[model samples]
Target: MDAPTGEQLSIRNRDAHAVVTTIGATLRAYEVDGVAYLETFGADEAAPMGSGAVLVPWPNRVAGAVWTHAGERHRLEVTEPARGNASHGLVRREPWTVTAHDADSVSLAVVVEGREGWPFSFRATITYALGDRGLTVTHGLHNLGDHPMPFGVGTHPYPRPGHADPDDCVLRLAATTHLPLDPESMVPTGGPVPITGHDFAAGTPLRDVDLDDAFGGCVPGPDGLVRHSLRGPRGGVELWADPVFGWVQVFTPHAFPGRAGRAVAIEPMTCPPDALNSGIDLLELAPACTWTAAWGLTPLA
Candidate 1:
């Protein structure tokens, strides 16, 4: 039988290795020096809980699965019916074609055709490259339609704490504000607020926290990059993103495939949840224009 995630493409650079799948252009696996930096699943199993999936056009949820653009109301399919919201975006399960590949990198592209809800056309490309600095992922999008298009980009990458127990790891982020969400709808209830106890700005142990929160006001370091990390006694992993990714979503679940303890997903998003309607930090691309952004993971010694 074929792999559930379609073609599994492998790339490596010396001690660093990664696997990118054609479906969703997912980052199926990444490791350096035989130490897994990501929580990986079997090639035969489908991605669970949005593992390594790319979020395009929008990330997180769209309230009521409806949004108005230029006076026309667009109703997207309610993917998260339980919450009465549209979860993620339009391209995660779609198939992508391999555009380029080499020993240390691979690129995949998917053309999102105009659909009922999203009446827009665009080509999204994702490239994964491994080097001495670990894995770097680049997302490129080109508006194929005549009119301007607004969108956001994000990714779900669950970075682990090497071989250490996840609960023993410390999590840190560069965000100073938090976006409150409704418990039932899981949509933002208000604007950002000064973060308090949930703040991970100074690094907090995973065992003491249970979070499914979104944070904004990300402050870039002197290098102009927003960084987050999970550190353990052995080693750690750092996730760094461009300043364009203004929001970060952190989720910690106790159960994950192939793991006994909690797992944390540090998602770097260009905008917050429901940006499709709120228009917060959404990027508008003119016809024939292309936009690109990047984020990466580096194993820390």
Candidate 2:
């Protein structure tokens, strides 16, 4: 039987290696010098908890799965039925066609045709490349229709603590604000507020805190990149995104498939949850126009 995630494409650069799957162009595995940096799953298994899945058109949850565009109300399929919200975006499970592949890089593309909720056509492409800087992922989207398109993009990558105990790892972020979510719906309640205890500006140990939070007001460093990291006794892993990504969602689930401990997901998004309704930092693409952004992971020495 074939792997549930379809083709497993491998790429390498020096001591770093990565596996990208055709399904969703997912990052199934990433490691350096034989040490795992991203929590990985088996080839026969689907992405668990959105692990390494790409989010496009929008990221996070869309309240009630409904939004109004040009005075017309659009209702998306409720993927998160229990919460009565549209979780993630439209293409997470869709198949992507490989456009390029080499020893240290691979590129895949997928087209999102007009559907019931999303009445616009667009093409999305993702390229994963490994180099001395580690792994860089670039995302491109082109509007294929005549109307303007509203969207956000992000990726779920769970950076692991390698051989060190996960509880001993420290998590850090470059964010200065936080978006509070409703306990039931898991949607943002209001606007962003000054980060307090959840402040990860200074590295915080992951031993006791449980986070399923979204942060905004990301401050880019002198390099013009917003960086987040997880460090342990052995080494560390850093995730950085371009300035276009102004929001981030960090999740720490107690249980993850193929894992004995909790896992950390650092998702860099262009907008906050329910941006379809709030319009906060949402991107609008004109007809025949293209939008591009990049984010990456680096294994620290």
Q: State the lDDT of candidate 2 residue by residue for 1-301, as single tens digits.
A: 8788999999999889999999999999999999998999999998899999999989999999999988999999999999999988988899999999999999999999967699999999999999988899999999999999999998999987667666888999998889999989999899999999755888889998999999999999999999999988987889999999999999999999988989899999999999999999999999999999999998876
What tens digits encode model 1's per-residue C-alpha lDDT throughout 40-148?
A: 9989989999999999889999999999999999999889988888889988998999999999999999999867699999999999999766899999999999999
TM-score for candidate 1? 0.98
Scored against the true structure, residue 238 in model 2 reaches a CA lDDT of: 91
Candidate 1: list runs displaced more than 4 Å.
Answer: none
